[model samples]
Each structure stands twice: as C-alpha cells, then as structure tokens.
Target: MTQVATTDRALPFDVEAVRADFPVLDQQIHGKPLVYLDSAASAQRPVAVLDAMDRYYRNNHANVHRGVHTLSQRATDDYEGARQRIAQYINARSACEIIFTRGTTEAINLVANSYARPQLGNTSEIVITQLEHHSNIVPWQLVAAQTGASIRVLPINDRGELEIDQFEGLLNDRTCIVAVNHISNALGTINPVNDIVRIAHQHGVPVLLDGAQAMPHTAVDVQALDCDFFAFSGHKVFGPTGIGVLYGKENLLEQMPPWQGGGEMILSVTFENSTYAGLPHKFEAGTPAIAEAVGLGAAIDYIVALDIERIAAYEQQLLDYATERLATIDGIRFIGTAREKASVVSFTLEGIHPHDIGTIVDSEGVAIRTGHHCAMPVMDFFGVPATARASLAFYNNRDDIDRLVDALHKTKQVFG
Candidate 1:
C-alpha cells in the first residue's frame, strides 16, 4: 500500500538470491529436486520470517497486553508492532483498522456476522462473484441464511473473468453488500475491483474484497481501491500460518458489533454487561498469535526489501513462459485464460483426473495443487471435477516450470 517498495533505484530480481532465503526450496522430494508450484495454497516462508518467529518464541514468550513484566512488554510490542507494520504496508488510514484473525476465512466470517448480519433483512441481498473461493462464498451464505436475505452471484465468462457488463445489473436497492475476490486463487483472474467498488458505492452498497491471492502479487492500496472491507491471509504471502488481517473502513468498523467476545476484546466485564474495546482489539478475541504476527511483520520486511515491482515483473515472465510451454502439451485444456491474470495456471488433461496428474508430478518432485482450488463453483461452471494448478512465486525459476512440463508429459504417457 503506502510502502510498495517500487523505487526505480531497486535492483533487478536475483532469482538465486531470493531462492537462497527459502531453505525449504533447496531440498529434494521423492529423490528428485523439488519444484514447488503450489504457492497459491501456501507459500514457503523465507529464513527472515522463520527466524523472527523463532526469536520471539525464544526471547519473548509471554501473553501480550496483560502483564507488567519485561517479557510481556516485549511480546506485546512485537505483536502490536506487527499490526503497525501491516497497517503501513497496506496503507490503512490507521493501525486501528487492521484486525488480526486465524486467517482470511475467519476474517471474512467476522465481517459476515458483525457487519452484514445486523444490516441484512428479509428483502436484502448479498452479491458475490463465481470467482470467489469457498471462504468468501460460504460466509455470506451463512449470514444470508440467518437474515432471510438472498445471495446473488455475478457470472464469469469462459475465461474465468467476471462479466463486468453484468455487474451493474446485479446491484439493486436490495443489495446490501458486494463481496468478491481481488484475484481468483483457482483461475488467477484479477477482478476489476475499482469498477466493482465504484458501481456498488453508487448504489449505496458497501464492498468487501477477498484479497488473499492479490496481496502477494501486487501493490495493494485499500484507499486506492476504496473498498469497505479487505481480507487476506499471511500464509499466502510467505508469512506464518494462523495469522491474517481484516481491514475495514474506520466508520464502518466503529458501527459494527464485535463478532467474538472474550478477554482482550472487552474493556470491562461484569454481571450487568461487558464493555468492548475500541477498533482492532474488539475483533481480536483471545491471546492472539504473537509469534505469527511478528513473523508476518518480518515477511512484509522481506517482501519490501526485494521490491514488489521486480517481483511482479519476474512472476509475470514465469507465468508467460509456463503458459507458452504448457500450451505445447497435447490435450492441455486451460481452465482459465483471463487476459489479466496472476501466475496461476489451472488446466485439465484429456481423460486424466487432476489427482492422477498431481500424483505423477509428485513422483517427479513437482508439487502442484490439484482440486477445485476451494472454488467448486468455478469447477462446476467449467464442467470439470477439478484442475491441476501450477502457481508461480517470485522464488520460482524456469527450471521449475520445465520440471512440471516433464512431469505432465509423464502423466500423459501413463494415462495413454
């Protein structure tokens, strides 16, 4: 956001240098060099993030914001310092807008209950797109079920891109909120959130963006997008798991009730009623993920140091190369071919199950995610059970894609 680290003085992306930071990428799998292509699922963290978490565990293992001891202070600082770093990274108006959660799933769920449920009525509608991951889809379903509101889905074209022409028609007086993914994890289709937000706001409706896939790939300025709520996970961005962020506009967050109740979320607890804390802390329920938060901060540091512009360019090259090479393979029907996309490639082979493709690739030490990619609706639209997805990261090189190609050849041979 504010800190995109895209200065012209930044150095070119040294692929080897970036690769060296992730020690897990150096190892072998199934007696072959590992070619990790599953970043869309969970990215491998660099040593900086790992070390940061390790340092916190070793030197500052204590409950945060509840004690006067030195360790407690250290832990609290580390945890809150992470919030500040994340806020700065995403260019939030204030650190108070960032709420920590288990992951994007919990983050979206928090808004579903706290923000949407109370506002929705029998005649209300929640608009989401077909490109959404299940995390984005199911939360709205639950809230709509509770409030007797209906869920309206914006359809996607054959290329897996949202049919932008239809977006305006979907929003009416009954539409309360529009939730869509910034980038589809399954299809890598980058949705036009600017248009989505502008049109939704014109109808006096708020928009929430599922930004899990977009956070790692691009510079995200929430203020620039002007979305009401944005959710993303740290694990998808080379940070530790079990830590994520929900960024809401200050005015909207102030009006919403706390989704969960417990210590730290409350200012005072008594027999009469418990008073809630303000801003971010009100949503963070219990002893938060301190080490993970610190690791997430370090992950942001690592990404910043490398410069996001270089990373995006390098990854685009990888995607282009992989797409060209994979197109050479026979019966390789691309599931999603959006003009604007991230590094993800989802495809299906003729008469070959995605699981079989994944299995054969694993034997070659090429790891890819093979499933509906948490977007079964996407699969249903394409009339496929699942797809083999090779998602690229900045650390990935041409050799990784080559290995995947060789593995796919083997899969085809085995199937034939």
Candidate 2:
C-alpha cells in the first residue's frame, strides 16, 4: 500500500523520485554509475515489492487453500488478495478469472493445453502474428504438433507493424484462435488489439493477447478490449520472477478443462475417476509461488499509485529522446520503426555484432538487451542475425540514454 511519491501529475513526471524507489539502481557497476535500461526483459523490483514478499514470508507463511489453521488462513488471504490485485490491475471481470502461473510462458501453455488442445481438430487452425515471442509461438507449435491443427501467421510489414489488411484473409471457419502480442517485445510496436479482437470475433474465433510487455507500459482493460485471454509476467512489471497471471473470460474458462492435475485442482478423487475444481484453481495446481504473488500484488499497488497513463506518457517521452539520440550514431540502423511504440528501441550498428555492442556497453555500466529477443522469426524477416535493444521504463532518465550513446561511441571507436 506504499505510494511511489506523487510528483504533481501535471508536470513532466519526476524520474529521479521514481528511480529512488529501486535501490538496485543506486550502486555503480564496473566502477561507473549504472544505467540499467533492459526493462523489456525484466524490470527492476522496487523496495515496496521486496518488503511485501519479505513480510509475507515472515508473518503469514503457510500452505494456501487446504489448511484451516491461523497461518494458512492468513496465507490464503494474502495469496487470494494478490489475485484480486491482479484482477484490478487489468480490470478483469472477476477475481475468479485470474489464474496464477510461473510466468507468461506457463500462462500461454496453460491456455494451449487446456483450451486450444481440445477445441482444435485436424482441420482447425491457430492464427498468430510474426511478432510473437517464443513463449507465444512455441506453445501453439506444441499444440499444433499434438493436435492435427495447423498454424498460420499474420505477417508484419516492413515498418514492423502487423499487416491488418491481410489479417482477415488468414481467417475462416477452420480458425480456432488468434493469439498476438499486445506490444512487440522485439519491435516495441503497439499492435492494434482492439481491431484484432473485433475481427477475430467476427469470425467466431476467440483471441488471446500476450501482454507481458504491454502490462508494464500501458493501461489494459480486458473488458474494453474484449479479449478472450490475456497473459503477462510479474517480473516485467517490477514484481518478482516466477509469478504471472492468465485472465480468461468466465464463460470460456467454464468450458476449458484443467491444464495441470494435482493438489489444488482436484475436488475429490475416487479410484476410478477424479473431479476437477472450479474457475482459476482449476488451472493453478500444486504449491504456487506464494511469496512472488504477494510481491506482484505490491508491484501492482506501486504501479497504480504512480498511475499508468502518466507512466505511459513519460516513457513515451523517454523513447523519443532515446530514439533521437541513438540515431545520431554513425553506421546505426534502427529496426521496428512503427509509428506507435513503447519505450523500447531495437537497432544495430553497421559491422558490429549485437553481442559485442552489449559487452562494450556493459563495461561502461550501460545495460541493454542484445539478441534475437526470442523473436527469431522477426530477426529472420528483417534479415538480421540479431539486434541491440535499449528498453526503457518510467524510472529511466535522459542521462541513461546519454550514457548508452556514449558507450556506443566508444564501441565504434574500438571497432575503428
């Protein structure tokens, strides 16, 4: 319930005050002040999130849902309270719609195994975009491999935006589901999800949004978008890793079977047959990441107190500045230049591998993610081996971008 300092929402957001909350950002790395900009991979957790997890373990540590003891009740309260916070974070219809998973990977896999597996037949198809992370893509491929269903990809244009014009042509009576990322992690393109959902719904196909990158950067309301399923990871939103949410429409969840079988998911078991539990618990089986869930709840509280719309605006400003600053570097080519973007910049310097760029930048205490970004298809389409990415957060300042630019200059100097 700690607020991340109200910095007069009218002004450009106070980035320093926001940075102060993340103690990990305070220290120097390799004798230079750290300019940690790799937020798209995983955001730094605030002290608020840290303390929340610590307090949960210290005071209310117990097995959830089964025990009738005092600690169990409190643990259950904390665990389920976290679920409520997640529901509120995304404006889900009910708390029951929120199911806990290890991360976005598990959440998508859960939907694939539980929902998509049974629904998809030999002739059925699953529609996805070229912009999907490996988490989003691999699950459907596994589903396709298991079921006789086929996978169709919606192509991205040269600008790295989803080609919405060609989207409808890929859909037909055989389409089972359309899963796309809310924001491309590799490109930072904000996909037009409302339009995607609307078009998919027209074909009577449900849609799932991979929202791991989107939840941290934008305001998401499941009801407003009317997406059938949404998945995101806690670590991407300044929460602890190994905890995430899967939000599904109530009616659909009621129809889908359990993805995993174990302790919490079962109602009763006879030798012959076993009955399943209801709604979310039906999906969340075994001992969940209880402390991580508490941390995620605290992270949501922190993000909410700061306000997401204002966060988005401030981060947009940072993105603009970073883009302009990086473009000044000689021999640099930008990737994924969509008009709509989050605070992530993906690019490469001429004749310099991204790994070398990352290593050189790290020595100067500037951190940036460099790889295919788990979107190998994206890399393939762009005809590049990999990209160097500087993903930002609200906590980042212009100084971080400046340091990154300086480090890249040094990289070029070394190459020269």
Candidate 3:
C-alpha cells in the first residue's frame, strides 16, 4: 500500500466550542463532570443530528417512493438526499451503490446471505480475520454452515495486527469472499485495507470491510480502497441508531439478488412473478428508517464542515497523550500497541478484574467500556477475559484523558 505523507499540526477547531454542540456532554455523573471516552461503542450525537430528525418527523413525515402527496415528496427528497450526501462523503462512484440497513450487522448479513450464499458450495470457503467483531464473524459462520462450506481465519499477531503473510496463504481459489474489519474495535488497530483488497482481487475474490469503528475516526473512500463492499453504522459515526450504510460496487450489486422481498424493493409483483427495482432501491426494502437517514445526513454535514482529516489528527493526538499518561500508572498493561491505530486504548491493571476497574472508574464519573467488546476471540488472543477500553472522539480533550488517568489511579487505591 502506498502511504500518503501529511503534515502534523494541531486541530483547527476549538474543542470546547465543539463540545458545547453536544448538550449531553455538559452534564454531571456521580456529582463529577461526565468524561465520556467510549466512542467506539457509540458516539454522542450533536444537536444538528437531533434537530434534523426532529424536523423530519414533525414536518416531512411520510413513506418514501410510493405516495404522490406533498409530504411524501418532501420526505422522499430528504431520504434520497441523505443517500447522495453519504455517497459523496465516502467517494462512492454513485449514490445508487449505497443501500440502507438497520446497522453494520444487518449489512454484513445481507452480503453473506444475498451475495455469498448462492455462490458458495461444499468446495468453497470464506476468509475472515481473528480481529473481526462478532457482527463480521457470525454472518459468515452461518453462511458456511448452510452451504456446507468451511470458514478460514487469518490470525493476528501479539500487537493485534493481522498477520499478512498468513492472510496471503489463506486466500485460494476456494475462497468465495474475504470479510474483515477496517479497524479492530477491541484493540484500535487500523488494518491495511487497501493492501487486503488488492491481495483478494488478485485471486478473483471480493472483499467486504466492516467500517463501523473506522468511519468515525478517518475518511473512507470506497473507490480508492476498491473494496467490493463496505458497511458502517450511523450511531458509531455520531448519527442515529437503527440506520447504517452498505456500499457495494454497482457491477457486483447488479449480479447479486435481493436479500429481502418487500414493498419498495420491487417494481411489480404478483403471486408467482415479481420484478425488482433498480440499483439501490432493490436492496432497500420496506418503509425504511426515514428520520434516521435524515439524522445521518446531518451527522455527515457536521463532520464535513469540520474536516475529517482534522478530526483524525486530533483523535490521534488524544490516543498518544492518553497512552503516555496511562503508561505512568503501575501495573497497567496495554492490550494493543499497534504502529497504526485509531482513538482507542485497552488495558488491564494488576490484580483487578476489568469489571471492577470499570465500576470504580464509573464512580469517578469516567465512562469506559469493560467487557469482551463483542470480540471474544480478541480477548482470548490477549489471554484475558476482558479489558477496560477508553475510546476517544474529537469532542474529547486533554482534560478527559487526565480525568480517566485519575480514575484509574483511584481504582488502584480502592483495590489496594
């Protein structure tokens, strides 16, 4: 993969001013200022997103594509407009390539069932990495089971980065598709997706990226990566729950059959004979998440107004600072120290269960995630049941990291 050189400079936006945009951040938890650091799970939505959804429901609420009334046209415009904005945000070839789903999990399941299931057989295999979230892993497992095919795993190293050598060896003629996460949600390692896509394409296989974590921290150009499919959740990117995107290459989508048969997805239907709609609407069935799509559009607009590159740089600095400060605490073991990462730090303190660490930190009003992080294989790789994860977003600053460190120290004191 070719590396692009960029200048290292401070983020341009005033983080405090940006923090004011999120009303939830200006509150107290346990009588202390709420220090939210678990953005990898779900980010706090700004007022723009909230207001967009509110506006959509209050004024333009209607089912899309079917009604001929004024409200229907307005709602349809907002929904389709959101699709276009998302396509531009990701540099997709056209808005038609985007398919709306419940979230990343459903998007992956769509590909697994619609595209891969019919193509795979007893001789075929599916390739994934050990670093994948449960959402990315489970769908393929179900596909393999139904088809009598096998599943192959690309292992990760001690640093939680994929072993590329093993990955190359695993890709063979029997490999039907390659599915992996763009970023490890459990460890924050940024996978080399461009390289992964190139390697898979060489063997006549397509790749699908689970971008739920990566989308919020960095810009994703699906065209540049050349991946066949990409999936991400709106909530993870500061949009709304129950809405996400699945972007597929137009040619591939044309070849794949619709996973669900319902209202808007079809052009005409009788008892036995049915015809499907074109491009995007073929995959997007039913009434769809109208307000959530509008909310996602507002979130995209918010992110674009504050440049994505600037957000990436700011979050990197937060990760570096937090890593440095947390390293000073005694007996704190870092779970993932990848050369390339996003805004997440997973660690475990000496002689303390991760749940205990989480509970103690919560008492001090610091929010962090403590569990297997929906990647139990990752936990097993590090030989721990779970780790305490503190993820960052652009809204976070040096003070949030300091408070987290102080809380960790307090946890140590409580345990002692």
Candidate 4:
C-alpha cells in the first residue's frame, strides 16, 4: 500500500496514488493482490465518489423537483447541478439538451421510441454498423420491426475498422436514423464519429452515437461532433450504476414525443388528454436517480480535475506495453487490430476456449472480461465464439499487464 497525498499537485496523476484512493483496489482476491483490468466494462469508484454518495444520503435524502420544502430544494439543486456538469463536460449547447436515464441502453431506447417510430414509416430505413453492442443494435431492430422500416448494416474489415466507403454508400434520403458506437466495446475500435455524423446530416438523417466506451478514455464534445444524439453510462466512467446521460439537440428533443409517461413528465393532466413537460422533463419520467446522479457529478469532477488528455496518454502507454508483451506469447493471437483503437486488448489462445482462459486468469487475481462482450455479431465477424479481453484504465500500470501475461503462461502449462 502507498500513502496518497490529498494535495492538489500530483505528477502524471500517480497510478499508485490513484489506486490507493479506490479502497477496493487494496484488497486481495484469491490470496493475491487484485489487478482490475476490465475497466471498459465498469470502473472502480474512488473514495471521493463513495463519500459524496454517502454524504448525500446521510444529510439530504429527499425527492427532487416536486416539493417546496428545504430538503427537496437542496436535492433538486444537486440533481440539476449534475445535469449542468454533464452538459459542460460533453460541451452540449444547453442543460435542457441533457436528460438523465438508467444508462446508455435507455438513452437509445428513448430516441428509438420518441424520434424514430412516428417520423419513420414503412419506407424509411435505419443504418448501423456490425460492431455495435446489443444495446445499440437491438433497440433499432425493435423499432424497425414495429414501424415496418428496414435495417441496414455497415460492414467492417478484418481489422475491425468500419468500412468507411461502405458506410458512405449506405446513407441516402430514405435513411431515417444512423446509430453507431463511438468505440467498439469488444474490439476497442474507435470509429470516426465526426465523419459519421457529417455524412448522416448530408443525407438529412439524424445520428445517435453510443459513447459508453468512448466517454471513459476520450473527451467527447457533442456540439463539436454535431451529433443529433449521444448516450453514455456513468458506471463505465467511475460513477454509480442506475445513472447515465442522454444529450440531444434541443429542437429535436422538443419535437419528439415522450417515451415513458409518468408523474414528472407531464404539465397538466386530464383523463381526456394530458399535456407534456418541456424538453428534458418530457424525457425523464418518474422520480430520477437522485443520489446516483450526485455520485456521477462527483465522478465527473474527479475526472475533470485530473485532465483527460494526460489520462489518455498514460492509458495508451499501458496499451502499447500490453500489446507488445502479448504478441511475444507463442499461442496468443490478437483480435481487432485496428490502427486507431482504445485501451482494450482482445485476444484468443489456440486450442483454448475464452471461458477457460478467463477462469485461469481469475485464479491469479487478474480480472479480465471474456465472451462476446454483448456483441455477438462482432464475434461472428472475427470467426470466434468469444475472446478474452483485458481493458485498461488510467490507474492500471505495466505490472498489471505482467500479471495477466504470467497467468496466461500458467494457463498454457496447465492445459498442455
């Protein structure tokens, strides 16, 4: 264990110091120090995030935006303040453009239901890439089925990069919405979202970007990208679960009908016909995740304080080191070797199932995600059922990569 300074000045955002801030990272798993390498799935929360949530629950635990009481005002201020922070973090035009949801899945569902269903009829078509997660793919499929619209998939090359030429070819006047991921969760491929948005706008189609993976490693400016809609989960960015963000252009959100109708989403209610609330409240139905939103706010503050560019550089170094080490292993074969990628490294060992490799790694206190990672189409494209994935974060170091490689060597010996 290392002593971490609470002082504001720290060089390179010390990995050991950051690790110390996360209490869970100090513990031993299976009698060995825990090496968390699955941050792309979910990141470990620091003391600051945990303490913020705890302080909120202990001192101010009340529903937001309904009551005129003091506690309600405080809670509502905190909740809405989180929205403002998210707006600034992603550089959206206004706070009204940001809506809170359970996570990235609900955000996409909101767009699919509110925007796509009514506007897009039988003749319309929705385009997506083959590398999207189930969250991004399934909702569009459901909307297409119900509305009698067609679904089109943009193919990817063997390196797991989207075929940009094919993507351009797929867009046309009939395309209603283009949904794609900013970064592939399974393959770590960072798609050219700016180009994607520009191409869709040229065809008069709205684009929705799933930033669940990209938000953690890169700075996302929705306004700069000129994307109509963007969705991301808080848990992937070191915040609590059951909280996420959905950013949409104000005019677009205003035009779309409410997806889920409940208490807060309405303006005036009558049995005959009820009026809906304005921009964001129209989309956020029921009581929102109050404390979780506060935790997410704290998480954003933590990341912003550290500066994203430095964190990205450090994580890339770890990625390069891990890639070199893994390439030296005789039976290891890397998957998704895209030129522009995030910190995720997915690979397979000859004559071994991904599940078996994951089990062996876990025995040595190395946590790596395995299986299709909720992207079955990506797996099918790579001609494998699944691959072992070791996703890196800023706090991880070369020693973590060493642990994974050593565990993999032990796995080969055991199976041989």
Pick the TM-score winner. Answer: 2
TM-scores, each model vs. reference? 0.97, 0.99, 0.97, 0.97
Question: What ranges in model 4 sit over 4 Å off?
Answer: 1-10
Better of 1 and 2 by TM-score: 2
Which tens-of-lDDT digit does each residue in 1-416 have in candidate 2? 54476756787687888888999999899999999989999999999999999999999999999999999999999999999988987899899999999989998998999889998889999999999999999999999999899999999999999999999999999999999999999999999999999999999999999999999999999999999999999999999999999999999999998877889999999989999999889998899999999999999999988999999998998899999999999999999999999988999999999999999999999999999999999999999999999999999999999999999999999988
* Ten-residue region with minimum lDDT total, candidate 2: 1-10
Report the error of model 4 at residue 279, Å: 2.0
Which of 2 and 3 is the better model by TM-score? 2
Question: What would the per-residue lDDT of candidate 3 be over residues 1-416, giving only the tens digit for each residue?
Answer: 11111223453656887788888999999999999998999999988898889889999999998889999999999999999999999999999999999999999999999999999999999999999999999999999999998999999999999998787899889999999999999999999999999999999999999999989999999999999999999999999999999999999999999999889999899998999999999998889999999999889888887778888988888899999999999999999999999999999999999999999999999999999999999999999999999999999999999999999999999999
Q: Assess the local accuracy of residue 402 in candidate 1 as a C-alpha lDDT between 0 and 100.
A: 93
Deviation of model 3 at 107, angstroms:
0.4
Model 4, 11-127: lDDT tens per residue? 555777777778888889999999999998999887888988998899887999899998999999989998999999999999999999999999999999989999778989999
Residue pairs in clash, model 4: none
Ranking by lDDT: 2, 3, 1, 4
lDDT agreement with native, every candidate: 0.92, 0.94, 0.93, 0.91
Global lDDT for candidate 3? 0.93
Q: What TM-score would you give candidate 1 relative to the actual structure?
A: 0.97
Using alpha carbons, what is the TM-score of model 4? 0.97
